[model samples]
Target: MRTHNTIPAFGLGTFRLKDQVVIDSVKTGLELGYRAIDTAQIYGNEAEVGQAIAESGVARQDLFITTKIWTDNYAQDKLVPSLKDSLAKLRTDQVDLTLIHWPSPGNAVPVAQFMGALAEAKAQGLTKRIGVSNFNIALMKEAIAAVGAEAIATNQIELSPFLQNRKVVDFAKSQGIHITSYMTLAYGKALQDPVIGAIAKAHDATPAQVILAWAMQLGYAVIPSSTKRENLASNLLAQQLQLSDADMAQIAALERNGRLVNPDGLAPAWD
Candidate 1:
């Protein structure tokens, strides 16, 4: 599997996973050799994820679990307690990584305050690392300046074939900031695109596989979600699928700045 700074590049996204679905998905993913699981306070399924992990028979040390703090929990006082709640729900003492879900524009807490809280959480063993999600270049710079370079591990964002995000990806690479690409399949839209279909056919793979391979080739960590066993299995196999330079160029040409998830009302301009 591809890895970025020691973290696995391929993970199972649990954005909308819940109850038995989340539990079964976690169990299936773990059994399928997925060491990374992504959850969030907003996902409302940490409890199920925890239950699945507990039942999966996988050692906690061998798994990399990630959770995120929602916008309402940004206050310094609220941060740690919120994390504790997440811990309880996840059934773990410490997660591998914790992220700020979104930088709420008007309610945006000072990077120093919350980042300091995150650092404190690390020191207290609440999480092994801390990072942010939906953060653009300016916010990432501010966060690094506030939290110190070594403390910021990653910046998760919406990235896929249609929204390549080359500028931010390039900037993150320069700063040694690894990126986790959520919505890497464009919420399943890319699976039906004619161009992607042709590329997948050329490689004897599915369109989802082709798009995911492209993301992996560009060195972005990917988290693609699916409820079906076949989809999950196919997605994991994306690691072994290779796209030629010409294929990559064609995929790159599909970028139209299309975004699948834009809770813009919850945050400022992503760019």
Candidate 2:
């Protein structure tokens, strides 16, 4: 239940999960002692996640649920309505955190408008914390400057053994901006990676576990998703697997500026 400064370090990612798959995954994760869960409007499974949480029987306060507003909802006018829709679908009064899914480049709405909406949401108790996702260093600077540092809490992005994102990570650390590493498993690509495999074997853990451990060691929150019960259980065990400094160094060398979640034109330049 450790948080990255403020947000939790380990959470269940419900990115591609849908229908009964998402429901079962959330339920299984909760039963396995997972306290954080991440979802988004674009993921199209918020309702399923909501149903699972309501049925889990865990008190609402014990869970830290996070969801995001999609890029289409970035405008000031669209912000609250989008969040309200998400809240209704999640069957919750308010989320633990709400993030701007992406920083749409050259959009008509100013960063201030979106960030202002986020602040208003926090003030109105729509979410306890407000953050951004897929924002680079420049965008982060603009966001903090506009919102004032205290208002922004985190930046969720892709961080794994292959795509290290060192510059952004270091900047975030220096600025005391928490980060949530999505695609920590690299969309199942890392499981077969030779470097990650060797490291996992050395630690007597799954590659996913090793990757997650690497992220944890760097103080970045991670949300790795899996539908199977065993995968979910094993992923949670990643918290207990500690990699040695030497192993960490070797894993660090494995970074080749690789990424698996390329959404083509839809995604902004991450480099």
Candidate 3:
């Protein structure tokens, strides 16, 4: 497994998945050798995910669990308490990484206020590392100012073959903040692209593997989610696929700034 700084380079993402679907996904992923798992407060599946982990019988040290703080608990008074609640639901004492799901809507909570509280959470052992997701360049700067660049582990964003997000990636790299690509496959949309298909055929690999390899080759962490055991098993092999420089260039040309995970009112002005 590749790791960008402190964050695992590849893992499983639980976004829209819920109930039995998510439970099976997490259970199968663990059975297939996925040690890192990503969940969020809004996903409402932490308890189910925690149950899968507990029943898996894997040692806690062998797993790298990550959970996000919902925007509703961004205030200084509520952030740590909320994280403790997440820990309770996750059935773990501390998350390997804790992230702000998204920037507060309309900046209802200033960046410093929540960043400080997040740092406090780290000091209290609520999380081993801290990060922010879906934050723009401006918010990143404010976050860096609030807690310093070293304290910020990563800036998870929506990056795929189509929406490479080079601008944000560049700034995050300049500040030594790792970038985690949430929807690296663009919700299976990239699997249907002709360019990606040809590349997959050239390597005798699946389209999903080609796209995931492209993202991992670029040094961005990926957490692709799949309900099927076959997909979960196949996706883990992406870490071993190496793309040639020409192939990387070919995939780079597929960028159209395509972003698929933007929620109205919840998403910020992306870079």
What TM-score do all the candidates reach, one by one? 0.95, 0.95, 0.97
- Which scores better on lDDT, 1 or 3? 3
Error of 3 at 168 (Å): 0.2
Model 3, 90-116: lDDT tens per residue?
999999999999999988999999999
Candidate 2 lDDT over 80-182, as tens digits, reads 9899999999999999999988876565567788998888888888999999988888888888888875667888989888899898888877787888899
Model 1: per-residue lDDT, tens digit, 1-111?
Answer: 113335678999999888999898889988888899999999999999999999999999999999999888889899999999999988999999999888865756887
Error of 1 at 23 (Å): 0.9
The C-alpha stretches of model 2 lying farther than 4 A from their native spots are 1-5
